[model samples]
Target: MTGLRYVYAVCRPFDAPLQAQLTGVADDPPRLLPHGDLVAVVSHVPEADFSEEALRAHLENLDWLTATARAHQQVVDALTVVTTPLPLRLATVFRDDSGVRQMLEEREAAFRRTLDRLNGRVEWGVKVFVETERTEQAGSEPAQPAPKPASGRDYLRQRRRQSRTNEDLWSRAEEFASGLHTALAGRADDARLHAPQNPRLSGAAGRNVLNAAYLVSRDTSEEFVEMVDRTKDDAPGIRVELTGPWAAYSFAGDETGRGEADEERHGESGGESGEEKTGEES
Candidate 1:
């Protein structure tokens, strides 16, 4: 149970208040480590649990991972209330405060550039789903029936109709997804498209055609949300789901958490997303 520092976020110094009992990973309250004008939010973690080897095993446990992500988001949410936060990907750790300081110094310029770019802005998530509708329409006609064909003619025609309908829906879904991206991007400062999430992973069904994130300004967040809402009526069969005013997780420099060097340091895997940090640390 040797101690290690679990780093949460980096930002310029601020005097705003945090919750009296703000704890990060494993129920450890976070504290700040300052380097020049920058500060890193960090917490003490037990190496037995956070060490690279331990994280690799623990991250595979859904309950642990979910709880950890919740705790991480809790901290990020708190910071968002106070200042512009550049959140580190999940499970970002260094051996000690000195190591954290050195890393901060090394990344200081890049960090500042990102913080400046993201100032007065927050990240929002958008996901689009298309429900299954049983119907046929014009423009995508089914193949003509084979003239006096064999035994399964009726069944084959039915299957072909279903297949054509699916193809048509897919085509429409693509156009809708692209249009949503374009429309949303126009409203926000920047946008990114991620792979559509799986139903099992996202806990929703139909088809996830668009998984995207936008960096919207603080003053225009309502406008952004409203615009996302407005997009719903634009596509008849598609559902555009919006979630956020979140910290800029997608805009973080290394979208895949930290690089191999960090993982190699702890002999663990990197975080899958900024929201989910599960892995061992040094």
Candidate 2:
């Protein structure tokens, strides 16, 4: 038999049935690749050849990645909706069922403990974007004739002024984001700051000020959304986009051999929420 690759996550057994009902990456039936008390949730990769080039190609295509991720997320969310699921990172793969079982056996205790901590909770993603303040006044500004530069000193002064303006804008943006983070922290179980989005892709003159994620209990989702909505209203200059109730993707770090150790030490903090906000680079 040709072996298939799989992605493993530590979740409650009750979630398996719900996860099966949800759609997954491929049309192939999803299965619970189980080992003892732990289960390795899996979907088969039907590709005949699992070469490095094939993996690279799949990873490079954003569309493929997003679709697969969304599909995988659907299944994961179904599980998370019922259980505290520790989501695996995108493109995590195992050579076969045996590999998954061996991993589960090796890290069984850690996985169980992680699941215990995450039970009855879900992840939420939030992003803040600041639209550039219009420097030019609207409807009244008239075009002025360019003034002739008398000396190189004048040109240098112009460059310096522009640079200073840019720096100040960025500094203000950071301060605003920091305040937002501080405010949201009170309402979240854990929080994380992600790198800001690029201005070009964000299409906002100001900047992508904040990228963040929060983990909250299922019962607290409403309160969390309310907090984010309030933050948006308070900060008119910045637009906040929220997404998810997704699996804890950003929180799940490298899970190779150290899977057990990692989970045991996986201290929860503020993490970037799983919001699918698009920027220059994902």
Q: Residues 1-282, candidate 1: write the lDDT tens digits.
A: 348998889988999878898888888898889999999999988888888778877767766776776787788889988999898877887898888898888888999899998898998888888765523423256545435535587778867877887777778988998888898899899997776666654457678788788989999999889888887866556677888787787787762263222222112333453334544333
Worst 10 residues of 2 by lDDT: 273-282
lDDT of 2 by residue, 50-86 (tens): 2344555655555665566566656666666666667
Please list the residue runs of candidate 2 whose C-alpha ends up more than 4 Å from where it truly belongs after superposition.
Answer: 1-3, 19-21, 47-53, 61-63, 133-172, 201-206, 256-282
> What is the alpha-carbon lDDT of model 2 when measured against the actual structure?
0.59
Shift in Å, residue 190, candidate 1: 1.1
**Over 4 Å off, model 1:** 133-152, 255-282
What's the TM-score of every candidate structure?
A: 0.81, 0.70
Ten contiguous residues with the weakest lDDT in model 1:
259-268
